[model samples]
Target: MPAIPPRFSVTPEEIDRVVATFYASVREHPGLGPVFAAHVKDWPAHEVKIAAFWRNAILYERGYDGNPMAVHQEAGNVRPGMFDPWLGLFDSVLRHELAPETAAQWSALAHRIGRGLRYGLVEAATLPGGIPKLV
Candidate 1:
């Protein structure tokens, strides 16, 4: 893949834009909308938190301090399968709003995070159930 253009920068402002745009898209999604609505009562506050999360995640700003797994665990509506659609929307927004290399980089990071979150959710659910008996 080509390197990011010299003029292209992944600043906090860009992260904010990506998060805002992605969430706006999510709000309209049928599968994900109700899940978010059930958990997020105040969108403005949630947006700020999500923006900080991306800044901390992609930019390493050290601002986000919440436990994502705990939040996900509390969100009974969110299923492990939802990550695929969530990441799809995220990848779409990143590709549309960023340079090719920038999009690629962020998309990869999002996939990694999504996978980890999904795995954590599943593990939390299964626990000592021990992978079921292989009948």
Candidate 2:
């Protein structure tokens, strides 16, 4: 099992800050910017959704409801190779904005999510008839 943070706690404010900075970085990213810009029409609304996603993920707040896999698959713009830079940016933001331990904890979660998303994308791409539709 992974070691839990004994002295650190994730808060809503921290989640919000991290999400804001991380997405801002993504918005400026050369490869990712156009991809995100093509999809999200409302930046503020997207920010709230992702911030809630991180809060619910790290804090178990159960505030997020959207299906990430479906969303990514539907994005069509997110290729399999893009996860690395996305995770890198996320880790960089966490490391810069939070305590080391807290950042690691958050980064670990991001890594897990990134891996899953990438795996799903890869599998979908390899399917015989293209990605299957989610019910």
CA lDDT, candidate 1, residue 113: 89
lDDT of each: 0.83, 0.85
Using alpha carbons, what is the TM-score of model 1?
0.86
Give a tens-digit lDDT track for model 2, residues 38-75: 99999889999998887677666667899999999999
Highest TM-score scorer: 2
Q: After superposition, how far is residue 71 of candidate 2 from its true place, in Å?
A: 0.3
Question: Model 2 off-target regions past 4 Å?
Answer: 1-8, 128-135
> Backbone clash tally for model 2?
0
Candidate 1: count the clashes: 0
TM-scores for all predictions: 0.86, 0.87
Encode model 1's per-residue lDDT on 30-123: one tens digit a residue.
9998899888898878888998987777666667879998899887766789999999999999999899999998898889989999988777
